[model samples]
Target: MAREIDQAHLLEYTGEFSFDHKLILEFIKTAKPDYDHTDPKTWPLITSAYLNKWLIKPYSGVLMLPPFIAYERSLVDLCVADREDGNVELVREDGVKTVRSRFHHHFPFIYNHNGHKRKFEYMHADHYTSWVFGVTGKVPATRTKGKDTPSASADPFDEILELIQDAQHAHKTDGATSLRAELESAHKDLDESKKRVVAAEAQQKLLDKELTHERRRAEGLVQSKKALKQDLQKAFRGEMEQHTITQKQLERVNRELADTNKLWREATNETIAAEARSKKLEKTLKDRDKDLQVSREQAATLQEQMVKIRNELKKGMEDGGQKRQADSNASSSQKKKVKIQQ
Candidate 1:
């Protein structure tokens, strides 16, 4: 099976960068930072600040930031679940309200965090995992109210939640970086592969055309063989007819010699003249046999040429078959790789 890289997974970092593992780790030490009383609240506050920078900006434009914020909100909701002990309390400037009712169940999946309306469901699961695991901390039940004592107290879920947040941010940032690099590499490979595919297609087309030509050539050979067979049959018939005519001529000559011998025997009694006539007939028969031998050699050469053509056609057919099979296998492998990616 062919391996295809997933570009999306390669760059995990995106959005507001809330889930950066490094940021989560650094955040754990501070937990919730103290508000500066000396600075005026209205002086100026950076609304777009993200511990994980990638988590903050959704895209290059204004359209990008909202989705990431939504994801971060979702993680917070998942993390802070309702405990049955009623120990949890929500404090405001007005006063402290203890969580008492079992009916509250859990915090809503959609809630406002840091004045931004964010939803946990919108956040990616990986982001949540990073936030939960990367940052190490404990969530204390109450905040100490004294200058000498630290205001923030460690709780069991604090560090874990922070880690989860950090991991997600780090994952996205690294993911974006890795994705950029990978996309570049994939693009290059894709271009090269496309070139190879084009060449393969061209070669396949040429093979197809050659195979068609070979088929036509094979058909022509078959026709030629049939014509040659007919020609040989005609030659054989002509040879037989000529042999019959020669035999008739030889018989006539013998009959004449017999008549002449009869006359000679009666006139002067001559046997030498009959012996010379018989030797001449034997020489004519030998000359006819030599002509037949030459004809047979010509036929044998024609048969050899026909056999060579047939062999060439057979070899061409086999090569074309193998090439088509290889193409089919390659196509199948490519399909399987695509399926795996899906």
Candidate 2:
């Protein structure tokens, strides 16, 4: 019966849910025990750090975005079930779903639709961290004037049973008078809750301003960083140009040096060949002189033998004289040939 009643209420609420703001405030407190949740200014800083840590991006924008995809918002239908069984999920994830396909980006939708049929006019700030942590984005309002208040419509004993009965006739029984008193008290409490909501909304506006200022300061810092980078690149560009010119000059000088080395090697080889030829010619002249010395010795021996023969044949004077003359001519020719050989 309770489940049926909850399902009926769910039918009436075709859109999202809204939970107590204190739950989120409590979450902030648990997340950062150092910061004071009472201080409105700290919310933005905490939220930014939370966003940066979980989503890999700050609260302002994404880290890297693609150029082809337009920076525009598109509507999507998020469907999920409110579980009651033992199965639960607790993984910390932060990202938008639409861009997860091709870009690998996970930024979320900024504008939260409030009413059942969300139109453009109903754009309001979502009182959420955008981090999915097993809780629905919507739940019933439970805080009033910094105090938790019970709804007048719900019965103290049995919420589902009371909801099943009509609101006008639910209290018309033995506990009717007490129920009326409780109802009146609940109404008074509701007024205080409304006042608290108003105050919280005002405080949220101040927080938004602080967030805006912080974002502007961050943007200024980014701009200054970009300017510094440009200046550094400009400075390095001159050195790079000089380096390129010096490298080219060195290459040209190396080529010239290589050519000089090649010429020197060729000249040295030619000199070696000329020296080898000169050595061979000197060896040939030495061998020729040795041969000429042997021939001179032989010619001297032959002249001595002819003189002996002429003495022996003293009566044959004419023949001996003619032979002597021929021998003298041969000796003179031999001397001339030896001189030419030297």
Candidate 3:
């Protein structure tokens, strides 16, 4: 995922300041030699008055003063100068002397010390100067006059020339700083854009590889579809040939069935003719048997008549014989009588 840009301004101090009240009291005492340090309330009042006089009053035009004072390890937090103006001189020894006088005269309880003591000198001047330069972007001015009092009437042309030089330098430095910041920002954007472009290119490569695989799969499917179509056409042709052969066989079977029916009809007609002839033959045989019985009865009656005729002839013959015998006897008797007479 892409990251969101951080649009917030960079913070100058990333951590909190470690405030040292003891250090602040010491700083106040340095400004006023006899400033009371015993009273618990006195510490806050004196520190408030000192900060108001030196730090707050000078920069009041540009920024608001914080309610509390804090310092870093190196006391850098004590420096709060504006970059646009060179007014840090107001927070130096000159400002401290003014605050001390207020405490000595008006608030004596806070500053109960002798008046004849030597004037107090503010310490950490170099640190304060360096801090001012860092904040204002202005170079520190080198002191050329040491213990020499300047004349009352100074050269106004020289002062005007120095002011012009300072203004020109400040302008050039500001322009350079702005240009540097813009260049750094551009470099950061370029690096982020390069990273995004690389990521997009990798993603495009993966998509291309996936597309190639899909194309191959589609081609394979097309080839398989074509093969299946050819097999289906071959199967359809074979089925058509088989159907034609089956139709021819069915026609031959129909012809055979018709021939068998014709033969069956002829056989049935012959059987009917044979049955009529056998019935006629049986009737003729019955008439011939009746005629044969009549012929046998006539033969028996002729045999009985032949037997009666033979018996009558035999009786006649016997009667004739008897008559002859009687005659012969009479003749023999006549003959015997004639012989005896002789």
Candidate 4:
């Protein structure tokens, strides 16, 4: 019977689920210690109730968003769920249906499987954090604020049940109560919730757009780096080719230098031999000139001796002729004296 009632309530709750800010705050404030942590079926009921009150019918303006404990600060968003143009659109996640609303990014949406038709808007701060975790998975740390609250010390669940009961009784049994006043309060709360949802949705859209632009810039930088590397490689290859050609030319010049050195050595030897022959010719000419000078002095001395002997011979002939003439004169005188005596 309890199971049947539970199922029946689940069906009804799913069909009428909507955001209700007051209900959410009340539930968190009044959660019992005995709220079954291990039961899967109970979780759906709890989640459906929570999402319905906060996301669909309650204040949809500002959502309280905190990071998932396991994921830590990594995945967190504050959302405003229901405003048009400023809302984050609902993108069907690959494996899951009814994820956060892509509309009004500031007010993130909550999905309850059992109450799939109703959408819930999260409060902009910690509220969105709780809502996201509740839908994706349960967060053990989160619970109602009531028993934890210092004010009314009582059984948490009973306290919440009594509060609901008293409110109902006040509306039904109390007479002469102004229905207009209560309706006005409800409308005011709903408007505030919607405004918060709009704000959160706007923030989420901005983040997505920024992330897309950053990715494109990174891709461009990578392409630029690749082009620079290719140019450097081409320049290095050209320099290597030039260096090789220069080295080959240097080797040829060295070979020509070696051949010129050998030719210089041969020419030096020939010059030394020519100088030796010239010195021998000079000595032979000096010896011939001294011999000719001695022969000329001897011929001049022999000619002077021959001229003195010819002069002495001529003087002897003149003396002999004078003696012969004296003898003739004497003979003539003697013959004349003999004739006169006779």
What clash count does candidate 1 reach? 50
> What TM-scores do the predictions have?
0.21, 0.21, 0.23, 0.22
Q: 1-342 in candidate 3: lDDT tens per residue?
A: 121111122112222211244664565556545444332112223133333445323222112122222212112112222211111111232232111121122122222222121122111223223322333333343232122211234323333233334434544233334433443444344443443344334333433443344344445544554565556557656656777647776676556546545544533443343344334434543443454344444445444443443343334345555767889999999999999999
| Displacement of the residue 214 alpha carbon in candidate 1, Å | 0.7
The digit string of per-residue lDDT tens for model 2 on 57-130 reads 33233112211111222211211111011111122223311111111111122222121222331111222221
Q: After superposition, how far is residue 335 of candidate 4 from its true place, in Å?
A: 5.3
Error of 3 at 176 (Å): 99
User: lDDT of all predictions, in order shown?
Assistant: 0.35, 0.35, 0.35, 0.36
When summed lDDT is taken over every stretch of 10 residues in candidate 1, the lowest stretch is: 37-46
* Top candidate when judged by TM-score against the true structure: 3
Q: How many clashes in candidate 2?
A: 8
Clashing pairs in 3: none
How does model 3 score by TM-score?
0.23
Stretches of candidate 4 exceeding 4 Å from the true structure: 1-267, 323-342
